[model samples]
Target: MAELWKSLPSWVRNIVVPVLVLVLAWNLVWFVVGVVSSLLGLLIKGLVVVGLAAAVVVLVKKAAKS
Candidate 1:
C-alpha cells in the first residue's frame, strides 16, 4: 500500500487532493442545504394541511347547526 501511494506522480497527487477536498466540501454543504429546505417544505405543508382541516371542521359544524 505504501509503495503504491509513493508511485503516484507528485504533481498529480497535489492537484487531485485539493480538488477532491473542495468537491467533497461543496457536496457536503449542498446536502445540508437540501435537507434543511426539504424539512422546511414538509413543515409548511403540514401546517397548511392542519389549517385547512380546522377550517373545514369549523365550517361543517356551523352548517349543521343552521
Candidate 2:
C-alpha cells in the first residue's frame, strides 16, 4: 500500500486534489440550497394553513353570535 501511494505521480496528485475539493464544495452548496428551499416551502404551507384555520374560527364565532 505504501509503495502504491509512493508511486503516484506528483502531477496526478495536484490535479486530483483540486478536482476533489471542487466536487465537495459543489455538493455542499447543493445540499444547502435543497434544505433552504424545502424549509421555505414548508413555512409557506404552514402559514396558509394557519390563515385558513383562523378564518374558519372567525366565521364560526360570527355565526354563533348572530
Candidate 3:
C-alpha cells in the first residue's frame, strides 16, 4: 500500500486523497447523527406512553377510593 501511494503523482497524493477523506468523514458524521436522533425519538415516545398509563392508573385508583 505504501509503495502504491508513493508511486502516485504529487497532486493526487496531496489534493485528491484529502478531499476524498473529508467527504467520507462528512457522510459518516451525518449517518451517526441520524441513527442517534431516531433512537432518541423512540425513547421519548416510549416515556410518554408510560407516563400517560401511569397517570390513568393513578386517577382510576383515586376515583375508586372516593
C-alpha root-mean-square deviation, each candidate: 1.7, 2.2, 1.3
The prediction achieving the highest lDDT against the true structure is 3
Model 1, 17-60: lDDT tens per residue?
Answer: 78989999999999999999999999999999999999999999
How well does model 3 score by local distance difference test? 1.00
- The sequence of per-residue lDDT tens digits that candidate 3 reaches over residues 1-66 is 999999999999999999999999999999999999999999999999999999999999999999
State the local distance difference test value for candidate 2: 0.93
Clash pairs, model 3 backbone: none
**Against the unseen true structure, what C-alpha lDDT does each candidate score?**
0.95, 0.93, 1.00
How should the candidates be ordered by lDDT, best one leading?
3, 1, 2
Model 3 ranges with Cα > 4 A deviation: none
Q: Which candidate is the best by TM-score?
A: 3
Clashes of each: 0, 0, 0
- Itemize residue pairs with steric clashes in candidate 1: none
Order of candidate numbers by TM-score, starting with the best: 3, 1, 2
Model 3 is weakest, by summed lDDT over 10 consecutive residues, at 1-10
TM-score each candidate.
0.79, 0.78, 0.84
